[model samples]
Target chain A: MRVSELVACTGVPLATVKYYLREGLLMPGEATSATQARYGEEHVRRLGLVKALAGAGLPIPRIRKVLQLIDHPDGSLFEVLGQAIGQLPPYLDIPADPGDYPRARAVLEKLGQIYDPRYVAVAQLERALEALEDAGIPMTEERLDAYGRHIRGIAEVDIGLMPTGSAEDAVRCAVLGTAIYEPVIAAMRRLAHQDIAQNFFQKTDEQDAS
Target chain B: MRVSELVACTGVPLATVKYYLREGLLMPGEATSATQARYGEEHVRRLGLVKALAGAGLPIPRIRKVLQLIDHPDGSLFEVLGQAIGQLPPYLDIPADPGDYPRARAVLEKLGQIYDPRYVAVAQLERALEALEDAGIPMTEERLDAYGRHIRGIAEVDIGLMPTGSAEDAVRCAVLGTAIYEPVIAAMRRLAHQDIAQNFFQKTDEQDAS
Candidate 1:
């Protein structure tokens, strides 16, 4: 397909398509003539994935990295994805140092102490730690397990929306799942605070009435 | 406090803080001296909110709009939030034309017909419609209800980890919840697909044994 046809099919503007090509986000099609380039189905699929990643709020550079992983599909995509989702600290870059892992581990341990009675397992903790290590930040195995347990409790609630399947599906679901659920969790936390305030007020009112 | 102080207190880079001011995402503090702008606690709070919104994947312009709503805090914030969250297709953002309302309603209704019996309530549909309408999308009440039910079913399992509160909290939670949960859900879905494939081979082996 010509650039115009590609643009129409993808619902992207011609200028934007050109911009993407210039930015190296889109590969050039075969040069059919001095003025024409012929694109194929690969371009269509790649374009769609690019758009999806962009919509998911990745920057052009990061999207490029993700696209590279998609092209390779050598399990690196999962690693990149795990890093993207698990290490997200309310939207900032993950800490650069493995040394910071201890502090992160502490936070996870504290959370585990709060929720451990709910039945999160040691193996789940190991899996989460492995995921973190795979993503390039190595924490103590013990810390990772504790963190995993806490996250698992929270994740289990979130995972119910997902269809049941294998560990790999679980990993992929974890990626997309975190993308959509973080905002919801934040909102819920705010709501919880509001509820606490309401309960406090109600208790005060009851005492005054008495 | 001067811009430096604001930067120090907020833990934001001076350049980023300046960018926020230039983008109108952060309002300037009082100018105490010719060269120094003195910021106060309000600036710190506003900056935190700005950071949070930015982290939530809103662009600077969109964050500015949301800040405007926060500044006003009358009837507009609800509308702004509605617009922001309701833009997600199929999940929110019902079309405006009255003719489209029925189709929206039908879609929701069909979803409700299919999924409501399992986990969601009729009331959720009502709330969904109200939210859509409040956001200026003008979805039919019936349609809104239908979407609510569909979403509720997905949300029900996840609600275990969520903090339940009043309707206001529900809206806030829904937006943030969706943001965090989407990625996790995607990961789970992928895991499920992988599991199915693995299980298929396992089942084949089992059938041979039988």
Candidate 2:
């Protein structure tokens, strides 16, 4: 396909595609003529993936790096993704020690004792700690388990919606769901005072009516 | 507080703050001394809000405009937010008749019939149509209701972790979550394929045992 066809198929404008090309974000297609370049299936797939990553709030340079990793497949994509998203803080590394698991479990158990059962289930908590450990983050087992359980519990109770599926689906859903909902969560937080104020006035009005 | 204090409080370097001032993204604090300017509570609040907005994916110029609206309070913050986030599409301006509520309800009911109960219920589709009308987006009741229901259903199901309470918090969590989780989700998706392949191998092993 030519540039026009690419744009039509991708729903991206010609100018925007050109901008991406010029920015070195999109690789150049094979040259067909003096004024034309022909793109193929790889270009289409790459463009779609690029759009998805961009929509998910990745910076252009980071998206380029992610694409490079996907193309190579040398190491696990998990490590590449962790680096791309800046999730692995500078001090941390991946593939945590098995010895840390017991401590992490203890922390989660402590968190469970503090919060409601629905907030953080034992199973999900364990998986999250495992994931963090597998990613080689330098959390003490206790801290990892505690933080994992706390965040998970807060997330579950607060979201007011749940996914029904297998353990794998639960993990996948949690990963994707949190990604999209973060903005909505932020917007809601900004409006927190208003929500409280409105609830207060409504309560007063109800008391007067009663 | 002086620029140094502001820098310390915000964890932003002085040069970055100076860049913000030059870009007109931050306002000058009260001039207390020839060489020192005193920043007050307002600066702190505004800077914090600016940082939050920037983190939530708004560009500097758009964040500036949102801050201007908050400073003035002439219009609703909801409107400012809608504009800042580009949530209100341009096509929502087509006019509709005054008595369109019934038509809207019918469309919503039809959507409720087709989509999953959990998705439809979480969307609060009926209420959103009324909100669209209230916001003066100018759609037919049916159109408004249908679109509102559809998007809400998708968002509700797609957003995995709920931070609970406050729109701003939701948006912030969504942004950060997206930033952190996009690559994670991609990794999980790959892992899912691996799981499938593993399952297939296991089944083969079981057959051989049999």
Q: lDDT values of the candidates?
A: 0.47, 0.45
Question: CA shift at A172, candidate 1, in angstroms?
Answer: 8.7
Cα error, residue A82 of model 2, in Å, equals: 13
Q: After superposition, how far is residue B105 of candidate 2 from its true place, in Å?
A: 15
- The local lDDT score (0 to 100) that residue A142 gets in candidate 2 is 44
Residue-by-residue lDDT tens digits, candidate 2, A23-100? 776889999889999998767766765665565556677666655555553443333332333321111233244334
Expressed as tens digits, the lDDT of each residue in B46-132 for candidate 2 is 566566556444667666666555555443333333333332111132224323435334543554432222221212333333333
Stretches off by above 4 angstroms in model 2 are A1-210, B87-210
Q: Count the backbone clashes (under 3 Å) in each candidate.
A: 41, 38
Best by TM-score: 1
Q: What is the per-candidate TM-score for chain B?
A: 0.54, 0.47
Interface RMSD of 1: 12.2
lDDT of 1 by residue, A94-195 (tens): 344434444333434554333121111222333334333332224434533432343444544443444345433443344444443333333322223233
Fnat of the models, one by one?
0.00, 0.00
